[model samples]
Target: MKLTNKITIIALAAIAAGSFLALAQTPANNNIVDEIVWVVGDEAVFRSDIEEELQQLRAEGSALPPNPYCVIPEQLAVQKLYLHQAKMDTIEAPEGQLNNQVERRLDYMEAGLGSREKVEQYFHKSYAALRNQLREVMRTQYIIGQVQENLTKDVKATPSLVKKYFAAMPEDSIPYVPLQVETQIIMVYPQVPQSEIDAIKDRLRDISERVNNGESEFATQAIMYSEDGSAMQGGELGYHGRADWVPEFSNVAFQLSDPKKVSRIVETEYGYHIIQLIDKRGEQVNVRHILLRPHVSSADLEKARLNLDSLRNEIVKGKFTFDEAARYASHDKDTRNNRGVMMNQKTGSSRFEMQDLPPEVATVVEKMQPGDISQAFVMKDPKRNQDVVAVVRLTSRTPGHRANLAEDYNQIKEMYLAARKQEVIDEWVEQKIKNTYTRIEESWGNCDFRYKGWKK
Candidate 1:
């Protein structure tokens, strides 16, 4: 009873547009009653919810399903089933993950709308209120995902089943594997001068001292100076476990027992920070901090580019192999030890489709052929929040072709496992719908549903 692709797309669009909140508010038409359209267990689905979803779909210029009235309510009803099961099982959504997701969503909204103020204006609520609402939506999504995972955790695609599944597929039904490449890179981080590092540390120390001496509030300092996304909320990082934070940040954050004390300057991959404890609950701690990053001078960047250019020329002239150079000279820790072969984090593989590479990397690699080394180029290293110079070698390329058992076993296996998992989930949803108590308004129940048991 999971939502069909059309419904799922509409739901995601509505959520992003903040139309989900319309369910709780009255419709603009004063004559139309906000009547209950369906009830599943103790939860009620209102007509306004369906109307709001439809309005969001129309606003986005999305084509509506022929039976949107029936489809939308059924989607809501199925969500209720998953939610109810999650509650019964006491499945708690990870708060740290939820907080991070909400923050990212807020950041995206702010970026799109031009500022935090515009985001609030667009949502018609205060930032805190909007965050809470987004948090609940994200929490529901997380719990539903967890519940679905729980139901299908044991489903697997064995080798025999994979072969059988591939054999049964019609010739036209087989998927096309896209052209992918394996790239090797050598990266050099532009060195920050000690003077810049010392300057940042000194600034943080001054901020910490001011807060400790009651000359300034830590929150105010964070708002004024913190470089992190949490600066909008006065650098407040809500309660999160030590595992949720980098070790350097968590170690100092958890050590703070006094709310009045300001922490010593702590350095992390992101930047330098001075923390102030807000509260602690069990293993989780909430804190506020201001972050400052040492500036990478133009001279340093030029030096890095020159060094990488020299190394690339040497490798191109066969003075040393690309892999050999990367092993000793590359600053990218993730790939340096692995002979500079980049792995796709999403797929846990050594191959990447063109669009999957970082934009800068993709642009350079697109024009390169197998065994060709690229010229030195500058790109942002998101992991360390710095700009780095690098050269890449396109080691191998696989051209696009139809998937087959011999050459595409792993890909086919993944496809089979995903299909099997969906089957298990769909069957579970069907049973849940049959067993669960449901009531629909007669007029709303007139249309057909994908799942049969909902009518009764």
Candidate 2:
């Protein structure tokens, strides 16, 4: 019983900013009990924290032991381990990212249970205070992840180990995998009108100069002018890696030096931007920026449609195959470069599943037969505030059901990689427990631990 309790606690703590502690329990009288339950290094665990966690679990209608208090010390012990590892690794996450994460989570929680106002009433704090608390907790959690990753990075499990692990699992425990594909792609962005591009760049330069001349604070200006969703929070991109951002934005953002100064106008597939550097350490950099995009012309769009329409007519008249016209007559170099093979971004497969088609194209292609060309339809990109005319060809279709080894190899490979990573991490945690100075309050002695050496 103790072993089961310990495992659950450790698993829960391993997730970022995960806390039952955020929930407030309904006791006979008060919810905020200030009593100390356990202490780890300099960190003290409170009875209220456990009760709050219990409240959340019960609210979710989760089954729990009648003796709920028995797990209190177990949770404390797990937190102590996580906190210690976090301190050693110096892990950090940005305040803005943490805040957004918390807000979205709270929103989901509210939808599931109650509103933020009610949540605050239960916690005895404002929404702002709760955000601050979660941010700090997440920061510590990041450290723990960093330390665990560093420790496990070298402990690779081989193919044989994976087969062994799979064989040990019960038949019912294996889930039917879904259809998935994986492919690598090099995207070619369509060329933007030179005049339109210049105009956006000019507008950004003007906005930057206004900030430079003391017109407004960079964040405030970003809030007013930035096109990204982060603009709501003063264009704070939050702490993220280069892979998270579009290539053009990432390229310029990493190059800027001054946090307070504005960057040169930059163009990306998304649109145009004037960026301001925020902070950097190692490979991570935070930035705030504003985007400006020019509107598309109806006249210009009709011109493109008329041109493509004529080319399509020529194809039907037997002058050329659709591919031949696509290579020479299409204005969009992105599709033209590959003879017009549209790849699904998520799956990276050359063949798009029905749902994989873009919304605008999907509506048209649903009624289309293979080898049929869709009439030129309009689609708008929010960043660019421009409508583009595109024609989709229904290349292939597959019925959905259980995934196969051949069709879902990439998905299976990812799952395999994840399982191996977890095994590596488990070993690493066992080692960390062995080396770290740990003193679990007498209450946790009954809990079974995978790391037997920690008993000392």
Candidate 3:
């Protein structure tokens, strides 16, 4: 389960302030003892809870906040408030979706800590016991998420409010806006010769036959031959959405209903893949595939370059608009629909930060002015792990500067809305605490809490 966007900042800050040495280190001869750290309403926060969270945050290299012991218990108490509200409201994530999330979390932990066995050992619990504990944690996290969303559902900012907020900030304190650019591209994927395509299909067919005949297991074959990163994990890509996959791969993968059946060779931008369905949970699925990419010949590469050049010429000469050309001629599925304007996945903005830009895209963008079209060039597709030809157009550019209301209205507006939302949550918390039966152990009340109402 994930925290809602609104509360994650507060949650992280509160979480980082504490240390749980016992959770971080296990002594060989000593028994681990957990005690009640705080009590909120009918719920109780345990020392173990703080330690587990602290251990995970520390492992992620997050900076610790001041007075963690006091800070973390307060956060836990606040979390319990939301969870209690969630119960009163009868809120819950779907059982299937919750189980999927649980398995995925376990998979990530296992992969990171080396293996499932190692994870169990580190936690000092059997797999079943650990799963049960994680289920409760995930359930509470989701409930808290629902509460956060409900609290801030009406929060918004107007242009006037945004301007006022920006005006109120000291000039020196205004955030620095980084250099950003909006780029458009028409990509040309080299066509694999029929012979090369046929060769790949033949090889996949052989592997399929081997798996069907019990001569080899699908995961075993994947380990020996799959080119993708999932090969190391026996080709198990944990539960993911249909949108996460290319059309060709997802179409064939979602069609396989039987665990024992191997799918036909499916061709996507990545390459030829033979899929094995591990399981399905609602709309999401867990599947494994072995990817085999065919070699693109020099002639094929030149052909693609020439084809893209023709499209670029049409766009540059004003015979066709760049967006028109991109819609009809660009082979990139991700960008073609939106007129080739590349979206920054990190920021969800049309403008890309320099460091976040792909090396090939950055090189062309550096030399081009806004509205300048680039010549056909070879660049690597990071996702497909293949080289292809493309032509780019730099649509817009912004120089680094201190943010102002005129140019950074959205950014300032977001800040204003966040501050307003925080105030609303704080007021709500004060009322909740006054009404709820809360008793914090006196020993836990010594730290400087951002929310003083917690002491009441």
lDDT of 2 by residue, 133-219 (tens): 555555556656666677667754465655565566567655564332221111112345789877777778888898888887887
In terms of TM-score, the best-performing candidate is 3
Off by over 4 Å in 2: 1-46, 55-136, 147-226, 234-265, 275-288, 306-357, 364-375, 381-386, 393-396, 416-456
Local error of candidate 1 at residue 82 (angstroms): 2.4
Model 1 clashes, total count? 0
User: Where does candidate 2 clash, by residue pair?
Assistant: 20-53
Q: Which candidate model has the greater lDDT, 2 or 3?
A: 3
Residue pair clashes in candidate 1: none
Q: Would you estimate the TM-scores of all the predictions? A: 0.82, 0.59, 0.86
TM-score of 1: 0.82
- Candidate 3, residues 311-403, lDDT tens digits: the string is 788888999899988898888888899998999898687888888888999998999899999988889887788888999999989999998
Encode model 1's per-residue lDDT on 1-456: one tens digit a residue: 222112223244355455533422322333446778888887778776677677666665678889999999988888889989998999999887777667666766664565678777766679898787677777778888899999988988889999999999999999999998999999888888999899999899888889999999998998899888778677887767789888999999999999988999998878799999998866678898888987797888889999899999999899999999999999888899999999999899988998989889999998989999998988988677678899999988889999988778999999999999988888988999889989999999998798889978
